[model samples]
Target: MTYDLGVDLGTTFVAAAVARPNQAEMFTLGDRSVVTPSVVYRADDGELISGDAANRRAVSNPERVVREFKRRLGDPTPVMLAGTEYTVSDLIGAVLGDVLRKVTETEGEPPSRVVLTHPANWGPFRRGLLEEVPGMVGLTDVGLITEPEGAAAHYASSRRLTDGELVAVYDLGGGTFDATVLRSGPAGVEILGMPEGIERLGGIDFDEAILSHVNVVGGGALDALDRRDPQAAVALDRLRQDCVLAKESLSRDTETVIPVFLPGRQFEVRLTRSEFEDMIKVPIESSITALTRALASAQVTPADLSGVLLVGGSSRIPLVARMVSEALGRPTVVDTHPKYAVALGAAVVARAQRGEQALTQRRTDTAAEGGKDADSPARGKTDGSTRSRRWPVPVAAVVVLAAIVGVVLAVPHIVDSGPGSGDQTAAALAPISNTPPLASAPIPTAGSPLPAGATPGFAAVSPNGRLLYVANGDAKELNVLDTTTNTKLATVPIPAGPPQFLTFSPDGGRLYVSIFDVSGAGSEIAVLDTSTNQVLGQVPVAGQPYRPAVTADGRGLIVPVHNPESVWTIDTVSLKVTGQTPVPPDPSWVELSPDGRKAYVVNRGANLITVLDPASGKITGQVPVGAAPNAVAVNPRQPLLAVVNFNGNSVTLLDAGTDTVTTTIPVGQHPQAVAWAADGQFLYVVNDGDNTVSTIDPRTGKITATVPTAQTPTSISVLPDGTRAYVTNLTSGTLTSLNLTG
Candidate 1:
């Protein structure tokens, strides 16, 4: 059987995507790893090794290495590798050949038609080189796809955009940064204009920043040793590799310790996230600038774009996402799996190319027999949920787009024969518009929570996304909605007065609610069986509870009581009170880390946040915050916490590692609740006083946007896919849905 294959022949790394039946499966090259370093090296016995093996030996055998040859493409210069003078094209072909060989071994056959992605900014000169390199590696039939288009295909595959909508592709890969704008229509993605590129900037640049910081902070330790030792080159090479790991580490960690060791020298240094950001700030800014230029070139503004799709592994950098979104004033959509998105997109391209070619041939045959014109609109096939069709891709337009996009449109009978047999046909598939045009998002939309004037405050989404549990301050019951239809599913009455906060256990089997102002009830904790919306039991408490958090183990429901100024832990399995830990006065909010090792609680009266050990129910540490701190959140991926201050009108960022405030960022008036976006890179604070939601960058401690909401948005929650953010109004009884396409 023939396979549809896409190869992301990146400069620093190589990723392959093979189209199977329904999904595009990604495969590793050279080694059994998802990503292989795109480097080729010769060993002492003259055997060629690439990827991790080549990268590892580079530190000890620098003379035999050739890395990042993609940067040198289009140049005819022949560089000496080992004992042979191989051109940049030759080296790339070798890498491409290895990738193809590995794929053949896995798939039992070579790809019938290959889709090779290249940097969008490449012109005919450079593109010609890339185009011919694939054929040289024995892949006779190849379709050239821009790196940005490949990334766009990945975004489009999710069926999110409307037909003919403009979307920008912001690619920050391991070795390069590229920004391209494309318009998705019935005829697939057309180049918005031209592509913009940063020829030598990417994650590698960030690694260099760490190296430079080491030179300055290490106090000449690395540099002095580099000059004296015969293996200094190898030592510096090893340091570069270590720096790459450190840079990636900072993505999920606030700080990491760098250990510099030699045969007789050893030193350990602490590098903070802020310091690393400072070093790479300039290069990171360049990527944002390139995105701006690409937008301008496309004759489109930030507001005109549907969204910015950020792909490539380097995009994992918290700084890159924040900066690009800030510069474009657009919601940047980070690829869920950045490294493989491009390769997966390639497979989509291959399928589209083959299908279009087949459909086009059919049209031509029909046109000759008194049938519809070949240039007519494409025939479509829809199934209510998805819309896919083959639009007419004129031969002329195909030629023009191919040249501009580094693609060689394979129009069998129309175009001149170039690669493979002249009769061989390929697909030039149209862009499938999956979702209908999105209507203007309505803010301040009210939902009729039961009990008439009961005000909806906070909501929790089931882990499976099957149900949305909405809580209110005056309602005596919990309102449940089927997330698929956004309608009331069931309302369960509670034992407490009004539910103020709702949370689900990690397993999503049990529901926990924090209630306040119960007339006869001393405690305000309610637990329910989600399978039937039946009340399981209520845990007795001594004070009014404001927020509820489930421990990492899903065994304890931690509730913070305001009046009593203590946190109570209820054993979920036993359905009884476990223990209570005393904190500062008016402790209103609580959040646990991803690992569930510790709990962060906000004490409003003392203007501080206390860290508690869940297992022992004891205060471990306290960090001073703004006045009247109300809501607190910890980024599960990073050791950072965002604490909202009601009285001070600011959010203080705390590094959980040190239990200290790194920066306090001003926000909208009377910030009530704060929650992290999908990836935990940004925080959304609902400002009750101003009736707006502030998007905050937890890494930089800055507010990016203050979107107006319905009256008194008390709490917020983002969907699992980061597509939507629901904000509940405390007084208006409305649920504001924000289109968070990013």
Candidate 2:
């Protein structure tokens, strides 16, 4: 009949939950939704309204409605709703009161204990106003917890955390962005450093960007509408709602259309995910920079953290996750329901605080039997009561009171507390699946294809991660697979010798395939127009071409060859061999830096990697690696490179800037190829002898997992989002797809 409750007073939306022992349930607020809009409206009769009612009435009576008051917590000015002024505190308190009333009505009684969550960077002025909210709502036993701490506590309640492990929390909500660092130990999750935030960046801003694009496409029709006209105002409001829907659709779809309605004109604007990403990349990048600063201020590195926890509805953007992973060089995780994490975590904290207080009181009552005193050093004051637990929060002002929540150690077997819970605990929750889950298209059965003698050699993914190109040696053809559908889209026949390795232009418009001659007579480089899925032509060369790479500018191609042991640079425009430089024997693979300033060739016979100048075909530096370095991979975001040694069974990491070896890691036997997860968070090496792929953490130099594959896995291509990888098997003549989801 009694339970602890937690509330997240967010900027655009509010969420609440009630906790009882091991389980917590989210309250279905206005209109049976788990979350309620933070908007408030005052009627002409001096009646205050909130949530869905306020949202529906705002368009007709815009002057009577006010929203997003949380952002003005410390402002001296008051917001006017229907000619009546109210402080930010009063607005927030009304939102909280509505949420509490809903929960109480559902349970037929008010909650026994309450806890609220707020941004970590809020100073004394803002926090003090929040401290008065519980009293305003007629709640007595209320405590406050920082938003980041609440998120971390929720993460720890599910995932196992070892003592002293650090974790970073990235919270991007509807109207604000926050970054924080936390450490887990015997006590609980503790704040590691000052939390950082960007006040004006979040999902709402992204919606505005989409709206602006719509306006531009519609010839500023939206801006031309008159706000004084009642019909125009309604149309504008409807358009904004449409824009929000389009933005959410773009997250799961490749493209969407936003319908625009004006006073006299109406139109629809088509938007693609790529275009949306470009528009918001700057602000998202800025958030990553803030996250890096948070880690630095905590005196820790990305390698020091077990993982990064993404919290809030905005963090679900696919671009956000990919950018965070690549920028941090660490694994990033998003809970099943990021929007409700703070509320559920607050509930956990509320329950733990009550449990600890009760246990401490029982001990105090039995102090005669050798129990510690009530005023022992372990006992701390929370809500003027003794709680033998401590929660450390960060603050710059001495008078800013930081309340600790989420003592996870006191929780035993906590359930998921998520929406629609049914015998599932938080531990059972899985990471967010790819926007469109990868379909299990049946691979070729025994007698499906006609290429009987084909043996797949190498595979490559396009820049957009839509198409996969696999080179077949015996069949002398390229098999194109549509990654989204997980099915073969088409096949391009090779004109000359069997294709060994495949590369794509930076723009993903052209495909370059290295044709290898089996008789050691001669070879050529075959070019394919990706748009048409047809071979354009082949450039005849003297020696055997093993693998080739296209320059960043897409104007030149770099190829490493055997027999004569030389590297060739061909002008892509003229299709002519512009320059050839002699190198050590058996130059098997070649790669160019992102800026096209340097080229690296892995010479299998020389047992080292050779650096060269692509412009003049001149040798610049030779970094010694393990024996028989067969492949090299350049990190997409960082100045790092990895080389796989076939004979030595090791991988050598190099600093691309200085051309020096940073470290060498031991891997499985007979590693054939190495690929960097687009984020550079993980390095994957395909072991031919072991028939498995070893996932190596570049930061720790430890093999995190070994995934079994088809026999003799030769090459791998990880998708741009780092969700899946395609591997080519030499013996089986088949391709293996590995799920790389974290």
Candidate 3:
């Protein structure tokens, strides 16, 4: 019998699967059915031992046994095992080899193909290691699939999903968490988005917590036990083993007894479900935050989902399953064996690759047949005749030949097509047009009649290059301007309270406005439908929402709250407060990078810009800016970051590729808002206090022009064509439109 294999090289455990003619099954190496604990022991003779053998040896030679090698997959250091130095890939290869041997033994034939699973967040370097490991085991034709994608594929295949259905895959493994949004279609599975969770967290964190609890109850002798003191080390190791068992047992029980053995004392401690939940509360919350962010990034809601599938062994914990269900308000599907699902899916993929089981072919039969016959003389003759014949040839031959040629050309065109084909074409052909019509446009000159005592704070044109939403602070309403006709479409009233900031959804269907209530009790976000110019709903926000940013998918909105040092995520569809993430104190503004992969938050209090992952709501990196970072902007065409410092009177430029501040250039005092010129050559910063706009050449990071504005210009917004810049002057109570193109 021939076999195809699937392997999941997990942090704490390794799983493998085999698929045959009519059966597909997953089994761990060395006698385990679902998973083989990823433990390796080094023998004195420079030999490596895995599986049950490694576990048995760990009791006698604890130092020689490595339990968490997967955590260091990206590390360059080699681990010494049995007097031999082995890289992470070596260990993984050994595990894979062992599994392949098992499959060969069982089927009497080596597997023809293999599929490997990896974390979605694994970057190029880590992915390289994953790709290299299989080669060490003689598996050359291996397909690498994301862990969450594998799980989602399994769910989709099992449920026989039709077109246009989305699935959110939450993978909480031993050392990492990842959530991916996928849509299953007739073509196959398409990955909509993937927001990764805390990479440093997993089941091992809970194990450590349980171990710490055991130590706390054991009168704080954990340090002694960890050092492996002859008497205490054995007791500590046994206690750790017990803690692990208890943690797993708690998955199905309300309470479990953890036994600890010491030199002269032996004790059993009863751990309750509530206590365990409390112990893991922080991690659970983090997971929920990641899930929420993923959904937000996908611009999807729980109600939009067909189902939520739980993957990874760590998700088996009752608390994890319960928290996911409670937070999403969707019934969680936890019936599948989390550890084996990925491997099983991989094996299925492997079998499909081997062409044993007939899955939907990615290529159409006509295309495949055309490809097969392309080199044949008969086909060549037909092609030559078609090219030589005129359009008025025999009706049947004309149709058939034309269809063949069209298919050949269409296949290549379809293969090269991508998400932004239409947008790119339109942008290439469109001419520059920045000015709005008289009726919808803001008056170019100052001293124009104010709109019913309205204090205009800022004006932003919608991304689609259509309407402009102007925040009228004094009038307590938003002035909607039509760009095409340059006319005011309508004025939508905003409830009076605190200063409000506005942002538009990705699709420009809705507008998000953050307002501070009168009592300072909290802030509220008002949602408006752009099509109707009507207020849809308002939800309370924590802290004072200063700069609001709608996620790229438009499902979630992020608003930076000053003073309280946090940012709140509002669910746009449900109009509910979903999650809150803490940021640096006194964050002045927040802007999403062009790719929508990261959020750059300027912290005036800390004089730094924190790079946050919007999906996971986690701070990934930070860069020191000027004295007080007041504004941040990202170039849409290039990997460049521009930051304006309120106190330093300088603009700091960053090369995003290296995450380093490349240069700094002096600008006007209190530069607040920065915008990129359409050509990406010039960056404009509004120096509010200086009443001037400083234009800097991004290539040289030098000041290019300093144009005076009305007194106390608060903000500056540029049209898509970059011909005019609308500056909001608070003191003058006027909008200044600068003719930059001229």
Q: What is the lDDT of residue 715 in candidate 3?
A: 71
TM-score of each: 0.50, 0.52, 0.52
lDDT tens digits by residue: candidate 1, 1-742? 6678999989889998887647677886645678798999987886677777787788777878988777766443576888788877877887888888888998898876678888654544466677789877778768776676677777677755566676666687877666555666655655654454545667876776688788778777666774545477676777777888888899999999887765466776689889888877755653543343355445666777766677888888788778767766778778889988889888877866766666767888888886867676443211111112222221000000111011112222222222122122112111221211111111212222222136787787765444567775665666665432344545566655777778888767777877777553555577776765666787767778778788767888888886577888888889788788878898888898777878888889999888999889988888899999998887745788889999999988888888888998899999998877655656788899999888876655666677887787888876553435677877778777664421
Score candidate 2 by TM-score against the native: 0.52
TM-score of 1: 0.50
Cα deviation of 629 in candidate 1 (Å)? 76
Across 1-742, the per-residue lDDT of candidate 3 in tens digits comes to 6778888878888888887767678764756446777888877876777777788877866777777777666544578775568888888887777777777877787888787887665544466667888788777867776666556655544666656665556677887666556565444545553323344567887888888887788787665543746556555666778888898988889999987777767787889988998898755664564454456445677787766678888889888778777877877777378877778777766665556222223234435766543332210011111112111101110000000000001111121122222221121122222222111111121222222125667777765554566777766776664332233546666664544677878766677887774455656777777666566787876567777788877887877886568877777778786777788778768888877888888888999998888888889998998998887888866899899998998999998777789999999988878877654656888898778888787776677677788777777666564434677777676666654432
Q: Which residue runs does candidate 1 get wrong by more than 4 Å?
A: 30-32, 44-47, 225-230, 363-742
Give a tens-digit lDDT track for model 2, residues 220-285.
887787878888877877887898888889889999988877877887899999999998886675
Candidate 2, run of 10 with poorest lDDT: 398-407
How accurate locally, in lDDT, is each candidate? 0.68, 0.72, 0.65
The top-ranked prediction according to lDDT is 2
lDDT of 2 at 738: 65
- Model 2 global lDDT (CA atoms, 0 to 1): 0.72
Lowest summed lDDT across 10 adjacent residues in model 3 is found at: 398-407
Stretches > 4 Å off in candidate 2: 363-371, 378-742
